[model samples]
Target: MKAFVIERYGKQEPLHLAEVPEPKLGEQDVLVRIHAASINPLDLKIRSGALKRILPLRLPLVLGNDLAGVVTQVGTKVQRFKPGDEVYARTDTRRIGTFAEFIAVAESNVALKPPSLSMAEAASIPLVGLTAWQALVEKGNLRKGQKVFIHAGSGGVGTLAIQLAKHLGASVATTTSSANVALVKSLGADIVIDYKKDDFAKTLRDYDLVLHSLGSEELEKSVGILKPGGQLITISGPADPEFAKNNGMPKLVQMIVGLLSRKIRKKAGKQGVGYSFLFMRGSGEQLSTLGELIHSGAIRPTVDRVFPFEETNEALAYVEGGRTRGKAVIQVVALANQA
Candidate 1:
């Protein structure tokens, strides 16, 4: 199958399209014919080798994280899904290759796509949706009537998070540019802070949870806004020692992470708040819950644009530009008139 792959890691390097052998299907895997895939900031980070120490990928790697596809075959031990089942997934981190025409995903990490969404829409949900689910529900334990702050409210994760927080009955606040204030509000953000015009940290206070996805400065500010005993979960970060230990990094790496996050962790402790880093993992169970939410209209996929398969690199560039309102998808399967 023809797929786009990075021969080496470099920020300016382009992905080369090449014919490659099919992925080997495991006993617990399902072979999927990918219809659409989504671009993520993690893809850019991986391609640039920014995460080399933490997430070492084999050279000439295929680059994509989320996909919506149809099952073409099922492994011997796979029982939850069968051939012809429509599904979507954030492929397990170690087995990522959703940029291709097909992928063999572990059955435990795959979920049926919501019938209410198109393939492109479904593709946009898994990664960002799962990120929100893990951050808010699993880690934050955000409850009804509580206040939560989500940064970058117009971005991929932020858009879905706002909806999910609202679905969980939390009063949501978010930071976005003036142009996107309306967009975030439409997604159920009760308070939209225009970051370009105002300082969110100075204006918002006593939040039960702060989902921090920005720089160190913003993260420090996020800690101040959280009430005592509140959680400050950061997706972009100086990975803390807890995350390092949980992921089983080398002792040296764990020490490095601890030192990097020492300042923020100490500040959080002084203020009686908790701080931790989150690197979301794939989970079929979580995706199933998200699918129900999408199907019920409690949440909706926000697709900013869809590029043709051949323009996959362009899609990545667009996402990296950081002007997108929501997620960007690549239509992998050619339409009737396309070459």
Candidate 2:
């Protein structure tokens, strides 16, 4: 099986294409023949060693998170899906390797792909969609008539977050460049602040929740936009103590994470708002809900570009460039070319 793997962690290091043995299927796993995979900022951070302390991957790691494909076989204990089932997933954190010809995903982390979408389109949904679902539905508890600000509305997570927030009945405000204002609006953003021209914190006020995904400067500003008791959930983050504790990090690591977020938490406290970091987890149940939304026309994927499987490295680089409108996908198996 051909896969792209990172031999070491470095900012400019390139992924090498290698023929590796197929992943072993566990009792509760499903073996999938990957049709398409998506690139994410998390992939870049992992490759650059930015998340070493938190996620510590084994060397020569196959690099990808989101995948859409067909089930080639199911493990003995897997019953929800069988051979030939079309599925998509945000591979479990510990076994991520979707930039390959095949992967074995835990059945609990896999969901049937939305029937209305192509493999590439379904490939783009899982990670970002799960992030949005966890942030808005699970954590924020967004409600109708409430105002929510989602930063970076044109980015992968932002594009989906805006739609999910709106669908949940919250009035959505988001930040992006002037060129993408229309795009966010089309995705149901009620207010779009051109980050290049205007500051989001200054533009949005008294919001019920804030879904932040940017630098510390923007994160601090996000706290100020919310009303008292507002929830600020950040995906791109200085991980908070709660997150560290929830993930059961070592005591020293927990202390370090706490220190990293102390100032921001204090600032949010002073403003009478709550701040917490959200590192999204893979969930087949949540993906199923998102798939229904996609099938119902309530949410749509915004794919900025599609790269061939051979250009997986270039796809990762493009995502690192931070200029994409939505998600970027790698077509691993051209279904049209298949006999």
Clashes of each: 0, 0
Off-target runs (Cα >4 Å) in candidate 1 are 337-339
Tell me the TM-score of model 1. 0.98
**TM-scores of all predicted structures:** 0.98, 0.98
| Model 1 steric clash pairs | none
- Give the per-residue Cα lDDT of candidate 2 at 320: 90
Q: Evaluated with lDDT, which candidate comes out highest?
A: 1
Evaluated against the true structure, the overall lDDT of model 1 is 0.93
lDDT (tens digit, per residue) of candidate 1 on 1-339:
989999999997798889999999999999999999999999998999998887878988999999998999999999999988999999988888999999999999999999988899999999999999999999999999999999999999999999999999999999999899889999999998888889998889899999988898999989899899999999997899988898889999999989989999999999999998999999999999999899789999999999999999999999999999899999999655222
Summarize candidate 2's per-residue lDDT along 1-339 as a digit string, tens digits. 999998999998899999999999999999999999999999988889999898977998998998999999999999899999999999988788999999999999999999899999999999999999999999988998999988899999999999998888889888889889899999999888888888776777899999889888888888888899999899886999988898889999999999999999999999999998898999999999999999889999999999999999899889999999999999999868632
At residue 322, give the lDDT of candidate 1: 91
